[model samples]
Target: MPHLTSPAPTTAERIRSACARAGGALLAVEGDDPVAVPVHHLLSDGSFAVAVPLDRVSTASHGMAGSQALLELTDYAPLPVREPVRSLVWVRGVLHSIPPSELTETLDAIATENPNPALLQVETPRSTPTNDDETRYTLLRLDIASVVVTDSTGAEPVPAADLLAARPDPFCDVEATLLWHLTTAHNDIVARLVSRLPASLRRGQVHPLGLDRYGLRFRVEGNDGDHDVRLPFHKPVDDMIALRQAIRVLMGCPFLNGLRARR
Candidate 1:
């Protein structure tokens, strides 16, 4: 795999897509004794909304309204692998608790995006104090000030304005399904795709790791080590049909002569 030296503007958009697709994020509160908690989150625009349990809320230094905090979200290969991490995104921001008057609206937005059952418990009533934990779920909005993205390439700071304006990749939500199908249902194509890799990388088992409008990413596992390679498309695609056409073109010219070297 080649290392990315020059920063790509799309890095911020990729980070946002990862946050949206991630099951949850490790939220680290900045303070004397920092606390890290895993909470389901929804990313929209430049902000993040996470559903935190009331019991664990206080532990988060900035769990209340008008506080500052940091959040870390990671994207990993859908399949098990020696090196699963694909990318990491760190967000620094101010935290603000959702007011009682806005709880319903917040929950509705979360459900609309994530459709997680835990979000529905926010409105359910319970009889016992222990079961009353339902009301304990609170939504905290993180007003993002800055975003940093790190991956095989390196760490790159993303301007808040660019991060806010960039949208996730067109296939962000269904990349997993597409990759799984490519790896399982189309072994012949996978083998042809692997042929495009450098001789040193051809020894390992090749599997689809990710896909986006720009290109496809593959994971190679061998005795030496695990490596990831990104194969760019002839042009950026916008829909499934175009994406399929790009894949066909990629497979047709496995060597991808004259194209930008993988990085």
Candidate 2:
């Protein structure tokens, strides 16, 4: 835990570098069982700093001296051709002693990219809802122990055992995606739409799409519209995979599942 006195000229560059380098780093911290978190944190003072978690953390280590831990970083880029699902890694770097500012900014980026996040408005049987209640902050503080970088083309095995130690606690968006298909078709379409898209045109929450009692709805920012996709002779193929799965279940019970009139 060292802090910088003055701002560094390359501070911004280093912050970006720290984020890029930490993509797959192994975060090691002394805990009851030695917690290992991902290293995709950012550096602010052009170096490493203590990361604050959104959830409850053990403050025992607060006054204790900081220790160093090793990390592994990975960056994936798609191959020139599209036929085979392949990618090329362009840049790779290792970091040490990352700054606190960088870490905070990095967490913000990850939070923004969170997939299927739970809305703050929804209430369930689980707990009481209140305006004061907010999303927990999942933070990753880094003190770069040592780092090694390589391209996907390289065959050598980069030892990142310490990196893979802790299970990545699912972020907000991730939780949403996991619980997405629980009772709605909205998530299915969103995930599929995002997955099938290229990086150039990939938009997450840019366009909010959902399903209602009637059918699906699509809108940008403040403008949205709902339309019945099902039609005679031609049907909306918007979500064929889900449609097919439902069809299979329906076919299993040819009686239309009690819809037929008994003679």
Please give me the total number of clashing residue pairs in predicted model 2.
17
Query: At residue 8, what lDDT does model 1 achieve?
Result: 29
What would the TM-scores of all predictions be? Answer: 0.78, 0.26
Question: What is the per-residue lDDT of model 1 for residues 1-263, given as tens digits with 9 covering 90 to 100?
Answer: 32222232287688768876777677666563434333445455557777666666766554456767778888887866778888888888888876777667766776776787666545333313446424455567888888898887788888777766777788888888888887789988888776766786667877788888888777888788777777777678899888877777777745433365579
lDDT for model 2 comes to 0.31
Off by over 4 Å in 1: 1-9, 31-45, 58-63, 123-136, 200-203, 222-224, 253-263
Worst 10 residues of 2 by lDDT: 225-234
lDDT (Cα, tens digit) per residue for candidate 2, span 73-131? 33221111212211121122322332454443454454564311332222222335545
Give me the displacement of residue 49 in model 1, in angstroms. Answer: 1.4
